[model samples]
Target: MTRILLALLLILGFAAPAAAAGDQGWWNKDWSYRKQVTIDSSPSGINATGVIGRTVVLVRLHSGNFTFTDAMPNGADIRFVDTDNKTPLPFHIEHYDSTVGIATAWVAVPNLNGGEKHSIWLYFGAKTAPVAQDEKGTYDPDYMAVYHFGEGPGTASNDSTANANIAKSAPPGVDDAGIIGRAARFPGQGEVQIAESASLAMPAAAPFSFTAWVKPAQLAGTQAIFARGGLTIGLNAGVLFVSGPGVSLQGKAPVKQGDWNAIAFTTDGKEGHLYVNGLEQATGPAALGAIAGPATLGGAAGQPFTGELDEVRLSKTARPAAMIQAMADAEGKGGKLVTVTETAEKQSSGGGVFFFVLSKLEGVDEIVVGVCLILTAISAFVMYNRFAYFAKCTKGNAAFMRQFRRMDGELVPSAEIPGLDKKEARLIKTSPLAHIYDVGIEEFNRRKARLGNRPLSSQAIESMRAAASEVVVHENHKLDQWMVILTIAISGGPFIGLLGTVMGVMNTFGGVAMAGDVNVNAIAPGIAAALLATISGLFCAIPSLFGYNYLNSQVIPLASDMGIFIDQLLARIAETQAEEAADNAMGGFGDDDMAMMEMDDSF
Candidate 1:
């Protein structure tokens, strides 16, 4: 039992558990064509292609080591790099294949003899290899790449033999070299090459499909890929038909050049037709004789290819155009193509942020500011009213005093004035302080009642004047009290409000520090709230201060004037005292005595 347990434990320790599934690591990389090249006199080439929308990358290493750090699945399907710079012949990329390259796509390649072929795309990922240096400094070739696009030795002798025999590099009616003469891959002949090795025989009993990628090389070409006699059909950028004495069918819409175009050619052995991007572009008569070469890349023998060729394919049965179109659509929809569009579109949704921010301030801010400002304005107005009240009070008092003087102008004599008492007049003129008519008449009457029987004296009259002055001072100060009240209301309220603002600002900035930003977006609103209090305070304070000061300046002088008038009354009465004493003995104060009191008091 112990041995069994130990064995189980050992097995458990050594065994690996199933790993959690994860996202694919090969997403969106541009390793579509990573051909490893070792050029010996420019003989090396890469034969690879991608779907219409896929990326293709081809590299040549001259004896340098390469490292592919990408952790891809299946450890990569193909590696084609050569490190030693030893040039090799171009490798064929079976075009029109649907399951072998970076992306599986159906394509059609037309034969020079007019037979069409179909193949699919292939995928080859990254790998690494180290090279060794030679005595002549030429490194031993060691590299890892993905595909091998065909290469040319800059001459027919050094190039792939099949590429050296083309009858025509530019066929008749091919107007633009931009579409045709362009390199298939850099330094490789975009022109067609004909050779015996590229042809294959179609079987006697089966239908066929041909597929490849092409850019409409020329607007018009005699026979891009065609055949004659009993053996087949041809294919090309724009037209497809039998290469008879003269047989051609042009594409309804010319194959677009300067862009990768996917073409599919399918036939039921009776009617042969061409399809571009999954849409039937043209139809032609199939060769009605014995089957010849079933598949041929580039052009027919002696004719070879007059244009670039990659990923040529041939299927034993005709394929539907919709299936090819679906694949094309899929390629068009890949993230690589969409990425550029989405980036350029720049669909910013900041409106959401704006809405969210404004939502926070709904109603509260407007309501608060409105109420505060209104209250402040009202308070300010109240203070202003207080000042105006005092202003009116002072002016009224001054006018009242003047009117009193005017009324006193025809003052009733002691005899005529019904209000004067007899004791008030008996000693009114004998006193040295005589202008105190208001006080003397009252004092004598009061004296007569008890110890008031004593006669008046100049000192007593002077004391009376001083007493009236005090009363005037007290009365004058009454309306001016609003000054102090208004001053406190205006000045103090705003200060308090400012204090609130300071506190609010401190809180806002403090929170800002905690939140880690001082941007206007973060700070403006808080500062606005803080400042609201200050605004309220000022709104309350300004009028208060203005009115308070205005009232104070106004009321003080009125009080002073009243007191001065009272003093003057005493002096005028004093001057008339001797005359009044005689007149009192005569038992009368004439109109002159009252008139003089009124005039002196007006001063």
Candidate 2:
């Protein structure tokens, strides 16, 4: 038993250190809550590969994915940090409408390796947090112009980069229900134009990439989506086409009409590539001379596109195919590139496993668990008290029995016992056998005084026996005191716990029925909380059961000792009376009679 206990203690000691070591401490003490966001770029997810350094990825938050109430209104408290939990990342919120539970933010990851996984942190729940939006910092220097089309209907789209390449013309039309947010609408005649600038100038055969989410209203002949000097990206019969200074490339497969598709065109100075929905659809050798002109979206003139466009980005360096694919997978609707978990809070001074579990419990479940805890405490107290009482009784009885056996047929007064000492006397005071012997001796003296110089009759001895038996019964009562409390704890603790579990489960199912959603994610927490009640019940009952059995076993032996002591005490009193009677009979004759008897013996 000792070895088993030491082994368990060692295991617990090691486990605590391991748990503490795994915890990367909270990012900020003031922020109360955070969520872990995992960006999976493996084959099972986005499946992009290459050195995709300092990439900006979009993070979408909605009611299904985030708990809006825990965040401050307008989302000023929102902060993004790296997996190290110390380095703060650059991010900007494009849109946040807490009332409707929808928001969008862009975060620049320092490094995103292809075919691997990375993680970041989202911290919130602070009341006095400063706004940390860094629009230009969220994007790298390669991005020349990026437009989200989130401006008001009559306002020109604002560029998100440091170049300040704002649209020169306001969009002629606007669609509120665009892909990510509101989008710029085109009606085959109007266009969004950006004037020529130093940032927009393209040198001869320079590498560049352009991408936009487009939803075509019409797939008519050769409609332009973007065009500049010697460069045009248009659609004919819903198929993608890109034209440069020396080459023209067209995709064989047509994009689905009226559905949002990611259209991209890239030129590495000598070759051109066209992608639709993140997949490479067409490629060809394409070269470009100095292209310096104002850019037009929806068409240069009569070739205007009759469609809506959102999230148009222009990069000076030709982005890798994998980077483009990752962007498409992350920003599109129902994309699985990012996964966010439930919010976790920083542990306070009073926080531990018990408090954490209590946070998950509802009101009634709390009461149930509280009651179970009280019962457990009570049972523990009873067990300790009873165990101590039993130990004292056992020790005292053993000591008194030793002294009684050394009496050698004599019933001596307790104080006059030959080997008695302060410690032994104190022990014998608690002994039930000692008390019964005292009672028997008192009864023997009373009967002997009432019948002076006469032997005690069998009836007299039986009377003294009855008196000792009465004292034995009283001692047994003392031994059995407070034992019922242990029995109650053993039998009732589990049933109480079971009651709590039943109620918790009923409430959980009722909540699920009212919510009208049947997914595992929605119901798992409730079920786990319900099961905690049952676990608590078992915790209360099992220990009580063991304690009651052990204490009961100890009480039985003490009661048996009391009964045996009473029997020995009555038999000793009867034998002493018979010996006294024999002595009196031998002393009946005087000295003359003794001398006459001696002469007769000689004859």
Candidate 3:
């Protein structure tokens, strides 16, 4: 029994690792750092290196003076894919703040996991939209404006988006060691300013979003990260402060100086929301008015930003919570990864019910189910065998009883029965009723021999009854063989299943502890796997229980038949002896009787 269980568990062990691996193929993952693809405003097609196992690629473009408008720049055609595969990989634009004469562009090239080095073709010209989708068809963000100040020792930084809004520096500018790419640094007096445009201004009632990645050198009186017309996102006294017309709200939490923090502010015409590091820190009711002035970064209204600011984004629409977190997640801040695979979602949404859940079962669960299957097979075999054997015994007993009833209490040799084939004779020899008849006949014959043809004594009749009853006991024992196996199946199946379920739960908690992930995704699979065990246990037990009840019902009647036949045989023997004794006491008178008396006739 132990060995069979071990074999079942072994078969189950392989299932989980394989299923886990198969699940991986449904998603885009293993996002290791790949080669950087370089971009420039000029049409000279440059080459970039690539690596293996990285499905997502980051492209850094260094265009010194040109501005990236909402549309792609003219004479720029940046085309790339795996050279061997020869398909255009999906791409998205990531935004960063600008510095003088030195701007940066971030493009994500996804699904490039092939190991072979691929040739990338690049030329600046008419281009398609930077929007791209994961395998699930969810679109990656396409920023309207992106400025990355990565150019070393340059006077003017370029705008990355097609919208031509470049920043010009007043004095000493770029800082090389930035939080991400190089950042534009400002002294108390220097400022980087973009000329006024309709894109730079926000509507009075329209939804708006603003986000910035900043590392503050000083958090004293007030320092503006970005200030435009009426809206300003700044730091004062170690706390983020957002101020607009009739709206002045400070973040509930404080941040330490020199640490990178993501701060955001969003307003949807009726309410304003503030965030620190991807978490909403404050909210208030409001309607923000439009801003008329040009946008200023690093320093605004004479209060200059002292430290590094890397990525800053301003959109005309308020972003959802998931998108807000995605922005932070893209830059390696606190947020969940957006899954590329839609397989799990598709399975759940399609509504196949229980079979779908069964497919998702874990290793221990599969093992428990297998054991239950074995038990079920054994139970079915036992029930079928018992039913067939009992039916045969019942038919044979009926046939023998029919022949015995027709005999009219006449004792005859077995060979004298008419038309009996060898097969029929063999069946009678093995039948329970026939065995009882043979036992009674043998006992009577032995007593008759001992008493010398006299009427049998009362003590001898009692002894024959005891001998016949003993044969019935032996037949009852034969009927009970292998019934205990059915009992074990009924009782033991559920307990084994419970053990598997408990082990599965333990494994689930252990995995959660090791990974430090306690979300629904982490918890659900384990719990589902655990419950499969109980399902299997019930599968094994229910059929066995029913089968045992049915078979036992048949056995009881056969036992009763044996007892009834024994009693009738003993009574007939007693009655025959009494009649013979009465006749002898009366004295014989007829000739045939006188001849029979001389020959010593007996019962």
In order of appearance, the predictions have TM-scores of 0.31, 0.57, 0.48
Cα lDDT of candidate 2 equals 0.77
Off by over 4 Å in 3: 1-251, 254-277, 280-324, 327-358, 409-419, 512-525, 576-603
Candidate 1 lDDT by residue in tens digits, 1-603:
212221222221432232221223222133332222211111121111222221121121100111112213322333322222222112222211112112111111111111111211222333332221111111111100111122233422112122222232322222111111112421122333323323333544346665555543443443344332333344443444343322234466555544546666666666667777656777776543445422233445544334443323444455555434533332321211101000000011122222222222213333433444554555556666755565555444443344335433233323344444564444433322222234544543444355422344777676666666555545645555445556566657676666767776676566444332234444565565566556555655675667667666766665556556676665544444445455555555578897997899999
Q: Over the stretch 385-444, how does candidate 2's per-residue lDDT look in tens digits?
A: 888888888888888889988888667766678878899999988877788888888888
lDDT of 3 by residue, 1-603 (tens): 432443333333332321222222122221111112322112221111222122232333321112223124431233333333244454433333322112222333443322222334222223453434222211233333555565565566556555656776532567665645567676665667777775566667777777777888787878887787867788887688888774677898676688778788887877888888767788997588766677787778866778777666666667555345444543432112311111122211232224334544456667777778788778888898889878878877877776776766446544456667787776676578888888887787677667644676778877887898899898888788778877887898888889888987877666544332344544565666677687667767888899999998999999998888888877766666566556766654788878787788653
Q: After superposition, how far is residue 443 of candidate 1 from its true place, in Å?
A: 4.7
**Clash count for each candidate, listed in order shown:** 85, 0, 26
| Residue 424 in candidate 1, Cα distance off native in Å | 28
Question: How far out, in Å, is residue 148 in model 1?
Answer: 48
Off by over 4 Å in 1: 1-385, 406-456, 513-518, 572-578, 586-603
Pairs clashing within candidate 2: none
Cα RMSD, each candidate: 26.8, 11.2, 16.9
User: TM-score of predicted model 1?
Assistant: 0.31
